[model samples]
Target: MIIARILILLPLVSANKPQFPLGIAVYANPEFDICHRDMRAVMETRDLKFFNSVIDKTRIYSWPLKNFKSDIESLHNSPLFQLVRKMPKGAALHIHHKAMVNTDWLYLQTYRTNLYVCDKHNHLSLKFFKTPSNDCNWQALYERRRNPLVRQVLEDRIRRQMTMLTEIPDRSDTNVLWEKFQNIFTFLRSFLNYRPLAEDHFYQGLLELYEDNVMYVEVRSGLQKLYDLDGKIYTTTETVNILHDVVTRFKADHPDFIGAKIIYAKSRDMDHDELRSFLHETVELKKMFPGFIAGADLVGHEDAGYKLKDHSSLLLEVSNWTDFFFHAGETQNFLLQPTNLQIAIRHNAKRIGHAYSITKEPDTLRELKEKNIPVEVCPISNQVLGLVSNLRNHQAAILFALDIPVVISNDDPGLWGAKGLSDDFYMTLMSILPMNANLYSLKKIARNSIIYSTLSENEKAAALDSYEKRWQQFLINVTMPFCDYTQVMYSWLTLDRNTW
Candidate 1:
């Protein structure tokens, strides 16, 4: 009797079953460049490659622009298109605030509407800075930059600088590429700090995610430092208040869009005392509103020279009280220890942001597998950071194989130069994981977004039910002639439609 019961229960535990949910995406912040979700001009151009780059083998269509018309009718009838149409991502659990707004939205904030950022000798500083000049279209930029094709040169530089991930990973001659990424963010920082500007960016980014099928966003925002339009240096608490207002307003405007669970972030440069103050702010946020501020994150270059263990005490304190949604093991080279993972396991982490280095420790990997902890996988960010040069070598691929759940995210889609959840999905499909991954597997991955999200159980169940219904309806609509669930036709006549 015991052996028979165990045999029956084995199927639930031993094997992987598909539980895919399709919901629209919701970004943590609205301003950041989130690739396939939101793109302007340059980032826009990369969408086709980003979206089609993955799952293209199974995709019935040739190019995204060519749409379905370029392919054979039979191609459109595949399970691939069905997955694409029906797949609904739950939420962007880990997006950065700077990425919530596009470079274009930031440009619009400034009086000089044209995005003519000049790069002389590969050192890019704002050209129209300190002056509100309206004669700052691409034409004026071309004349100032001197190359007859100055606008094109500047645009190419902007495009190249904006898209640092597309470049080849050459650690040898790294001066140009490394500086370019920081400079781009620095330029972005100058624009996003103004309260009004930040609000606009935040709103737009969430809208973008909503269009791409993301339901909720738990975005990371830097509160340790502020640099931009604001003269006074507001404390972390003040920053959270501003962010709360922004998200609240945005959510009010769009009833369909579920807003942010502010993941208040601290940089590695912060001292131990500063870290405590940051956590205090997070605790206060929890007191303010249950759903408004979700948790805390350790953003920035953790490998820049601080061990996560340096702040272990404070981390433990936060874990003792509040939940921690950490950016652990993001570095490909510098961070050598797995202390953060242990911390998360001990504390009972909500979800790990970018647990890329878990493969290095065999024992820790076991702990994670046993805990069933989900890792927030950011493919483009890792690629740009040179952790996994391509998606083929992504750590998330291994984690997924172990049946450890992972939710795909665009860490800084604008900074990385891609759009929407589709970009990350595309990369995971083609370069990382399995090239021949079926619709069922892809849908399961999409569903993991909701599973790993901070959403309540009831909300998740409703969303999952909606997704299943959507899939069933799509199947019926697409394969109407073939689908015979009752088998009325088959029972009445001799037929052979047993195989799909």
Candidate 2:
């Protein structure tokens, strides 16, 4: 392996390197795993760069693909993408398996081969496919293009197909996005669950995410359906088995997935004890699959009055091996939002999923900063939730600017109707947060993701080196080749730092 040794030794020997730190989207929820045409379409909107200082700047390294024209040219005539493919990215911190994964693949697994999709009007719905017939199909969902309400339903279902090409304004400022967000889940759960849909969705979603350059995804999902009795009841074990099976099969397929972690979440509208039991059972079940299972969380409308503080005793009682990841400060409706952050940290949370309001409390902000905690900044989620109407003032800038380990993610890319991580990064880089867009800065963001992730130290180191080698080689070739960025923009390269 002389070649391998030299490859590792290469970067260390270079000085004044044009090398870029490895970068990645970290996480693209199955809910938000839209493909290529959809990704290009999303980046074309007027508001795409409506918030970034670099709105007029030539696209480069991190989000070049957002500029299909330039990227396509580079793809054919330049080596930027070749370099990009070599860059290493760490783990994707946020994901919702059910919503993030593609449902079509799931449909196929459970013997759902037929079609019940509405045409002309544009809508799709699957019902008892096996009982009826998979062979005699009326029309696939793809062919049917239903009307208004139906279109809205279909669009919502496929929102992860890509970020919406046009902006859809926030419906109500006061209604927390978390409130409206869960409806997507309830809607999907209410509609699909007959066959082993989780497996289909998980695989497809992972494939979509991998295509977007996301290696590891920590999926946060509400509990899989425990039962669907016609006014009948089934033990929670049935649901657990279904979830376990999905993970088992998924792991069999995607080894680099970094694995899926169950959120063991529940809607706050349910009985608290019922939720508690699920949490406890999930912790107990972790014995069956150690590293793959992450821990528990409580989501749904935050105003529903079931605070993490309420579960403090249970949380303290649980072993540290079973981590706690909370969705805190997602609400403007309650002052208790900050308190949730406090409890999350005090209880030793692995990370805060969407602590948007944590900055409002000066002391808590200091604590978070000092602790080196990461804020899972989901810009689209915040916009959709109406906590912040524009990316211009998204709190991610505050956390990131100050060097708080912050990682950008597509919280529910599917539901937000967006593609994978890069599009989100492009939107944020070009429009909103004026964070530095150079190679080192982008790599640091990627490192923060890995450093702050729940992955073990060995895993993080391995991922980090893997990313470094890839990026270095890509960049090295750029300098040696005829059309590298440095040579092509020799004039700009020597310009004052302020010109950037």
Candidate 3:
């Protein structure tokens, strides 16, 4: 009789245990639970197939273990990726403005007339001119693309230069990778600096995010001055107005779109006075465009640049004027004293970008949890930039395990041919989170993006309400009798077979 009582109590004890990683309120809903089970089964089957594949066997332990550039095409063909593409991702809080749209769209812009391209030591730079001048061997791209053979070869070369895609992603030297990465931005700056093209670029970027089911975004933009075809330069305010116009037009076309905000980002490589001037300008812009300018951030590779604490007084002073979404702890060097993570927390950063090394600092992690500061985790960016070899070993997995607030973002999706937040979200679900993580995990993460966003409380509430409704509809769609998972898989394969 005692043994029987113990067995019955054992089941009760198991039931009382908390869910791993974290628990979600929606876990109690029967419909949601059923949907989650179905989704989990699909995810597990994909994992099994991926792990048993011949390529996976020779290369890495798992699918995400491979370089993102090499694996991105295959991921696009995945049924799981398709499902993620259809889900309502709450917000993209850490995307770079210039790198938001894919290179394919940028390549199409080269077809415009009077566009000049200068090739120097195998590096390409583009600019617009009313009349061609002998500036750095400026050749008319219009004439270059006139030949079918030349157009094909030149397009391929330009696309390759514009992206970071490589079969052998450099793993040994991060400095080399960063050098190449920064160079791509430099090459793009000339091409995108044209006012008309900039407007189109911003609009296309929003469309890409919207099509990927991301409702809102906070773009980390440099707010650089733009020039017209006749070399008429527009002031910073003019540029901001242009961007605002693009967002307004986009939202009008897509009524469901919640719109975008700019986190005016300046490079950390600036001197003390330069940053102070930039901060003052940022404050003035925030005043000018109250609803559009969300905050300020210093973006660049952390280790090589001045630390956040280096400009403490200026940052502290500006903290009263505007909020901060500082990029901190992106480095792999943990032994550095008063790390960026600690400094960012000290400065009361609203959101931490790429806190990849946060796991190494227990005290800092505790402080982040206590302060409820969310870390904008970019999984594929970290992997591609040589911060971590495999997503399974990424520090974000630790953050998830500890229940620390995390918002998955795409730092520079366009640079790698990724469209939106879906790629990063897919990586988080497949590799960062535990295999047992269910739909509740995804829901909670999506919700957190809104909660920790720069949106006002009222705006956040409305966004969450909208998100909840859409999420429920998604659940219903996936669970309906006519929604055959096998058919979806086969269809994706057929559609993407050409690329494969």
Candidate 4:
């Protein structure tokens, strides 16, 4: 009896050791494993250790931002942060177009002559007029900036109203933050509507993303007309054409960039008739600018807006070729199942943006896996918007474990004072992912962004090739200091995807 018991205990003890860790198995594809090996080798170098030490020291000085913990702010000055800025971010698929540039740029642009700010019932609206209007009590921004005493005060007020950097009110109240967030966007409309400012906005924003190593992007816009300094508005077609012109000019200067596309977004609050008209308009625009316009989305606060099922008839009216990128499951309502997520899945949405509440329904989770729907997980955006309290608890890791492809994005980086996807990438790796999440997972995430993007097959191949070359160069630069000369056999080129 004692011998039999010992034999059973021995088998149980051996069974406790997993045959393969989940992360490793999930990322065991040959192409990915090879690339990850090269990336991992560089990340483990002594140079990276020193970089991490600098980050560790700066954690104490980080600001207590409402979006992320103080420690995440600490990475702003670290060398690893610099390295991440160089890492191939693949693509930005879910960012808003107007929120792409910094607010300071808007403030400076409004200082030009003829611009006026009107305050009505504690709400501010900026407009351009030949002269001040007595009926609306319009204040000229140029005059405010000219006075030394008012200059600092005016700048402070503008920064606080346009961005979330200054004091945030009522952290516990998501409603308050949501209202404040909507107000900021409203205030920005006055400045962003100007044609010249809109042109400058696109140029500077794309340049910033290019500098931060993002090759492609799909910016969502409401397709609103841009107004001239005299308040004369351009047509929606003209507005999109203007964006294309700016993109063309930028590409002329930077040929290595894969390119950018647009996804027309309409608020979910619109009634059935309004949504039907908007859908027709979007379809017309897509025909006119087939290469530039990629898809459409229903955008707004999910909890308070109309559910996706409410527009099932209208959504089904869209052509099968047209992509539907739905923004669903962004609420924290545990009592309610994610019916919006289910609707998106049923409609065959090309991708889902911020499916934060998917964990509440297990059946939907299984469907997401079986259908292979990719999710655009914006961590900092989720935290800042009050959908999530901490990045560590974000549920993005759950998606990864379930074989749901995910891509990290900075939904509104400019509003939160982030340069590009670099900060979001760092936050996801350090705070959101599990401790066992390795370089392989990072590579897979990057590749997923490219493969799942709207880029054509030829463009995808070119982008991946470009990304691989830059990644190799980055590894060589960081690891050359401590690399052993004898261990050069597994160099980036020498290790093919077919090899181990």
Local distance difference test, per candidate? 0.57, 0.54, 0.79, 0.72
Kindly list the per-residue Cα lDDT of model 2 for residues 1-500, writing each as its tens digit: 32222222222211223222223222211222122222222222222232132223244433322322113333322222232333444556766655574333433432344434422233333433323334444344433434555655665555422222123343544443443455456446633554444445655677677766666777776655532323223344565566667766766776655555566666544566775676677778676656656777767656567677776776676746477777887766546543788887887677888888877777887887777677777776666666665456667666755666677777776654444565455455544545323334455566677777767899888876665554444334433332345443453233232211
List TM-score per model, in order: 0.69, 0.67, 0.87, 0.86
The residue-by-residue lDDT of candidate 3 on 1-500, one tens digit each, is 32122112221111123334452222333222323334334323223344343224334335677778876777776555666787889999999989998988888898887799888898888988887667688889988888888788788778877889852664647888888789888888988988889999999999999999899999999988999877688999999999999999999999999989999999998998899999999999999999999989998988685788788888888889998999999989878788888989988899999999998899999999999899999999998889988888999888887878889899999998786998898888878877655445676788899999988999999999898768756655554443466644444334321111
Query: lDDT tens string, model 4, 123-214?
Result: 66777777655878888877767899978876777777887666352264677777777778888876787788788889988988888888
- Candidates sorted on lDDT, descending: 3, 4, 1, 2
Point out the worst 10-residue segment of candidate 4 by lDDT: 6-15
Which of the numbered candidates is closest to the native, going by highest lDDT?
Answer: 3
Q: Model 2, stretches more than 4 Å misplaced?
A: 1-88, 102-126, 129-167, 170-180, 226-257, 319-321, 431-435, 473-500
lDDT of 1 by residue, 1-500 (tens): 32222122222110122222222211121222212121111111122333344334434222222211123233334333333433566678778877755455544454443323434466454432333345333233434556665645655555554445435544423334445556667766644555555566777888777767676788887753433332455665677777778778877887756557777777756898888987887788778767777787776664565566677777777675577887777655534554566665666677888878778767877887787788889886666665654456678778866777788888877664455575677556645555334434555666777777777898777666665545434334333333354542332233221210
Supply the TM-score for candidate 3: 0.87
Runs in model 4 with CA error above 4 Å?
1-41, 44-66, 69-73, 131-135, 334-338, 482-500
Q: 1 or 4: which has the higher lDDT?
A: 4
